[model samples]
Target: MLRKAFMRVFSAHPIETIAACTGLFMIVLGVALGTQHGWVWFWGQVSAVFGASLATLAVVWTVRMRTTETRVAANIDVLARQLETSISQIHKSVKSGRDEQLPPSVYLAQLEQCIDNLIGVSHELGEITGRPMPYDVIEMMTTRHTLQIEAHLAEGKPAPERRLVTETDSCPSCKQTVEFQIGNQPGDSAKPTCEHCGQRFHAHRSTSGSIFLRLPGASQFTRAVSVSCPVCASKIPANIDQAKQHSEARFCFSCGAKVSIDPVSHACTLISKQDKLAGRFDAAGVFHCEKCGEPASVLTSNINGTFGICRKDDALVVLPAAAAQGSPKTDAA
Candidate 1:
């Protein structure tokens, strides 16, 4: 216990402890000799020892303060150099990104790297200054940049095939199925008024390309539907809410055929085979040359169906299918 107490006090104030102990030892020696040397001599010795102890303490404290200041200044210099290096690296990265025509995704990734470097510097600064780093601005900047990149990428790509289809959603107020027409564009939106309750609701495309209807302070919902591909007979999953205000094109995954869905009739029609490039049938049931847009005459009929063939300038066009019946027939050359 004694040793622990002594160590605690000595570790906290070693110079003061040593000085005080030396003075106490001298006083004790003086007390022992006071009986022979008298009280006046003992008091004189005590004053001298006390003054010396105070002088020693002052000198030690000044030296310690100077040493601590020097160490802190050295640390600060090292930290300053490190910070300069980090900033230089950040500038180089920014310049490189500006000089190169990088894709939006690549540019955003580099920007994120720069942000991470800045965050590291912020952490270092916080450690030195004992203050919390303000990260809200950084977060906001990151989010803004990410959104801009996303918008740029979206605009660069071709718009998805748009088709008008009827969508059904339950009205929050009336609890009845509300039917409306919408486009299949992924981000397209509409405002629909409920017929049953006259309540207005906001409708928009979800990330999965389905139409979602939502009322104020209410959850969103969608109507699911499935259709079979006319060419391959494979089931195609779709959301009715994704139908557009006009006819749009869709590709069948199973047979690679471009299929068109009638918005009003909900019928799937074969447009063209994606791989074959054999041309498409028009709305009027007339087969046309894929390259020249000229109506192709039926070259022959078979058990499969009627095949149309046409010549565009020097190129001969062969269509995969012809009108069901009454198509113009041509003699084989």
Candidate 2:
């Protein structure tokens, strides 16, 4: 309480305090020189000493004011840099779509704290120097923060569960079961690859199961026609990535027929077939001739030496096993 009162008075009457101190010092000097000097000389000496003391006080006050200004300016610069860095980080998080690193609420809290500190420093600087600080960046960040908060609040509500649509189909080339997951979007199709033959295809069907068809061309073509081999009438798999390089004509394994496709109309036509391409199944072990589409027991090994047949056309075919050969390891998924 006493210190506050003293400070209040000191700030209020600084000139008066300096004048009193100078007057007291002048009087002491006059008394010391009274024996040698007359009253007129004493008065002259007192005036000179008082003027010197006032000059010294003026110099000291100027130095202290300059020092205070320097420190305040440095502090403001530091605060401005900190504010810039914080805003840059916020902009990066928004730009790169990496906001998941920090949740919206948590990031908002951090930005609010930084803005508060910046505003406080700006206010202090404005009051001390009587100059307005540039706060356009702060205002922009505050506006963005407000918009983000509103978006979060509006979208944060719970939503109803959507019915999941799934379709299961068999691959025409390998007869592998292919399951597709259709999302809630309208006209959306699922592209599933066959694990058995590595063939990829898109499955599009209505919820009512009324419209079901395999796209004739690649995925890029808006128009699709149902494709079947002219000889064996087997379905074929093709996609955009495959069509870009070249149109792949499918060879029917069931009938040993070479197929050709019309790129514009997506029509399938059997070009030719060699009888020698078909191989007869004589062995007991399962054999899969992709060219002949022969159904036999599953072959366990990929090495032809284990169990394989050479065609009359001198073509060696590597077949995948359809099932395990009564082995525990082969049966494990």
Candidate 3:
């Protein structure tokens, strides 16, 4: 126990113990010499002790500076390596067109994080050493990385409005390549009839990846049917259920014309707004549009409640049966 305690005290305060021992030895020597030679010998010994203490402190400070410098350099190296690895991974992803692994937004976010780390390391290195930091290489790498990302985004973009895609498909019957119109979105397919053969397919595709299939018989009709506007020749899309319910009206997208279609013939016709409004009820009674002044044969009971009337320009007018009483007659345009 005494040996262990002596070892701990010696390790903890070796410098203080050595100084105390030297001072004690000098005091004993001074006493011996004072009986003979004197005060000059004692003063010289004190000066030597003070110089040794200052030299020991200088050595400790130098060692601390060296240890700190080495650690900072190591940290800078680690950060640089990490940043490089991140950049390489991003470059590989862009090259392989494997951006699905991470979305562009996520990729950009990671790149930003790496750039921040690189910037922090550069700043720390600058603070540690007064030398000019080599951040130009980092700046160049960042610029190049940014350009690559932008290029990938540009490549993913759709064709310009002016540069229309000529959708080429061969007709099943005629086997002739037909180029479709310009405005359809990507993957928009249709069982378009061949202009030469008048052949049509049972299935079709819309811009939003919706499939429209022609029904086999009377009970079920095609969900979405594309028709042309009689007045403007522009395409109009209609849903069969909406046409039957009369709750929703289909109108021409190009011209402000009311459009109706024969489900069997798929014949599109332009009708007056008054005719469209009047078509919303059963034929048991006559009804009139107070705003348009056109009369329609309808069931009074069906229309006695408030009816939502869809007009030519997509405006909805809610009307009650009492508004149908007497109105100025107007002709269809």
Candidate 4:
């Protein structure tokens, strides 16, 4: 126990330990001198050793403080350099995006990467300075850039006027009707918090330029039908509105081919290959039309069976489904 205590004390106070050892050696030498001469000489040596130890402690503490300050200054310099580099990268990305007219998604991704680097630097600076990093400014700038990207993606078109949409169904949390505003373009989305129970709602615009609202846990009540893809013959699970008996187009995960299925009989028909189309699916599985390159919308009825609809300029083009054993037809609407 004594050895461990001595080790702890020596590790915590190395200058004190050295001074103690020196004082003990001087005391032993004084005892030997006292045996030869007098005890008064030993007491004088003890007082001198005590004063010298205090002087050593003060000198050591000053040196330690200076070393700590130097290290801290060096760390701050490195962090500042890192922050400057991140900002430079952001500027370069923005300049290239403007010059090349990059796609909105690509530009937004690059900007986000730069912002992440800056945020990392900010966190390190906060740790070194012992202050909280203010993220409000960063968040505001990100939101502004995102909105600008969204506008650019809209192809210079003014966004549709905002309008309140009341949910037809009640909220799952409180069983109260929720109303939210949606002003997103054909490819954007909005998330609004529920007033009654604080639940969040997602509002998305489809490729066909239709807006739809989704409530939490709403998918559990949705019905799905299994059908085989006409292109790859792979099984695809497609969602359908049971009450309205409406079916929408779905992409086959196996072959990446868009197929339309009948809600009643689950008859699948090929619409077009994903590579030949210019659209993307949002998080809610709703397609967003980037360009009307081909017939991409699905229409199914008792008489028409399954067909694809495409909008080109001012006219509507109808494309008959490519069934396994039937001739395809094309019509203009």
Candidate 5:
């Protein structure tokens, strides 16, 4: 009797075992049966009790449903409808002696968790690539979720083939490739940090990555060449990141001078009080200019020098050739 009782306790999960023990003990006592109860009946009682516990767990977890499952299920419903229609069309074609070919519905599922771990040198790829966790980490996460959906769908037999749909793509942080397989999660957003450069993957890329501006009622967008931020006194650049980190950037929403870029589309437009003037160009061929600046962006002069407009003070000044050997006015242009 003691041995049978011990076996019962050892065979099941802690909680399930406890419930089985209590319920079984009650059954034997209620029936006034002792150890002599037939083995078949005793085992049958235990199985019944275990089955009840399992049903309870199913309701609590509903572990079958997930985001991927919902989407796949919707697709399945649509496919079923299409299949029915196709079958009807095929029957008509067959009666008329046409080809019996039907369009393909490719169904493939990936299970990422099932992927094996790195064996030798590939495991060290993390440090070499400067990634805290290797690409496999994301691949694993995506696969785990994917496997859950695939397991449920596989029972449907020849799954109605269709292109898979997934949320998110390429990791913004690492710029690393995210490749997933059948029954694996696809893409996810990852934020990376560089300890050496203090650069944040999702943050400013150039201290001037993007910038924009808004006006009271302008349907057409325009760039603000150069303007002042009355509040901070810091110049906000037409480029957002540059203005965010550098003092040379200027932004003032008041009097409608602001620089911002559409976060989603990355389109930038500058809003300024007046046309900008002043310009410079580097060897790489990138142009730097203001409206007034835009025209003077390139140094186009005749006779070796010309008078350009005073930049901030709104005055014009002459660009003279090398100070006449003995000239007192000696300012480098």
Candidate 6:
């Protein structure tokens, strides 16, 4: 009864702050009268009246605060629905297997949008949970969204087939067959080694197009340097030093190696470091392709991690793997 009457007092017709206060005072007066006229009863009335007034004020504050919270929640719910709709559309478009059909910039833009939505909601959910939200929830949602799109392009994002040119009995580069020397004693017998001295270098041949360096700083559209192809009259720039990590932007487009990229035009300038581009340079680094007896060094971009290989022709190209082989390793996250 107190609650109903208090609410009525609050919402009463012709409501005024002072009139409401007066009604509240009268309600307390009635409670005091009901305890009878004895001195003990009169003191009890006083205590009850004071306690009830304080309780009423607290209830009023709580109700106002809750009502404001309800309005805010309703607005958030509206925005959440919009986020859900956008996510659904993105899911369909990305999974369509026609990324080529979409604009090139679309992928990056859409990915950014998807991430933004996920992040916004994650923060909001964190607020509701009143604790640090687990990263798994956000990760799972994003992973599913990203993977679903890639699934349509490459069969469930399989491990790209990597074909490495391994050391064989016959060197693919020199075609010199390695032979085992006959030794009477096993302990002193050196295992079968490369017959060709210095030419025994392991030349890896994988069409999988290994990308060891990618320049995120490089502008869109392919960049080129002035160099000629050794095999063909391809006027492409080649730089032998492009194999170093610091020289990816200077990588050549024709030979798949790092070159000196022109800062203004984004063109690569050929630099001759061919003395080290053979037989043993990349024995520590990744690239080991030794075409024309010249093994070039390699460079990888830090941001995109696109690998570049140096060429004897003093040119670099986007290191590509064998055409029939699988995709190259990427430093892209």
Say which candidate scores most in TM-score: 4
Candidate number achieving the greatest lDDT relative to the actual structure: 1
TM-score of 2: 0.29
CA lDDT, every model vs. true structure: 0.53, 0.46, 0.44, 0.51, 0.33, 0.40
Give the per-residue lDDT digits (tens) of candidate 4, residues 53-161: 6556645774786688889898777667766765776676576446543333333444554554565566557667778776533253335345444534433434445
Give stretches of model 1 more than 4 Å off: 1-40, 101-110, 136-333
TM-score of candidate 5 against the unseen true structure: 0.17
* lDDT by residue for model 6 (146-230), tens: 4434432332233333232323344433556554332221111122335675442312111112221212221111112244433
Which residue ranges in model 3 land beyond 4 Å of their true spot? 1-36, 98-113, 134-333
- Tell me the TM-score of each prediction against the true structure: 0.30, 0.29, 0.29, 0.33, 0.17, 0.31
| Candidate 5 vs candidate 6, TM-score winner | 6
Identify the runs in model 4 with alpha carbons over 4 angstroms from their true place.
1-43, 59-63, 137-333
lDDT of 5: 0.33
Candidate 1 C-alpha lDDT tens digits along 1-333: 999998986786677777667766665666555555667676757755775676577557757866887886776675566457546655654563355322222333434434444554555456567786665332433353454345345325333456877788777567798898776644456678999889987666543345545565422211223478888899754333222343444555445566776554567888776543354445433456677788654332223343343434222234332333333322111
Put down candidate 3 lDDT per residue, 1-333, tens digits, no spaces.
988975775575566546555655655555555444346666655645654555465456546656786898787676567557646755754542352332332234334434444544454456557555555322423353454344345335334233334455555456676545432332233345667767664333332223333322222222344688877788875544311322233555344466778755667776744322332221222233445645321111212332332333233233344543332222111
lDDT of 2 at 323: 29
**Candidate 3 lDDT for residue 105:** 28
Q: What is the per-residue lDDT of model 2 for residues 1-333, given as tens digits with 9 covering 90 to 100?
A: 988975764685577556655666665666566556577677767766775677577556756766887898877676577567557755643542242432233234344434444555555466567776655332533343454344345335333234557666676457667766654422334566767787776554321222133433422221122377686677642221112222335444445466666655576777776432322222222234556666322111221221223332323333322322221221100
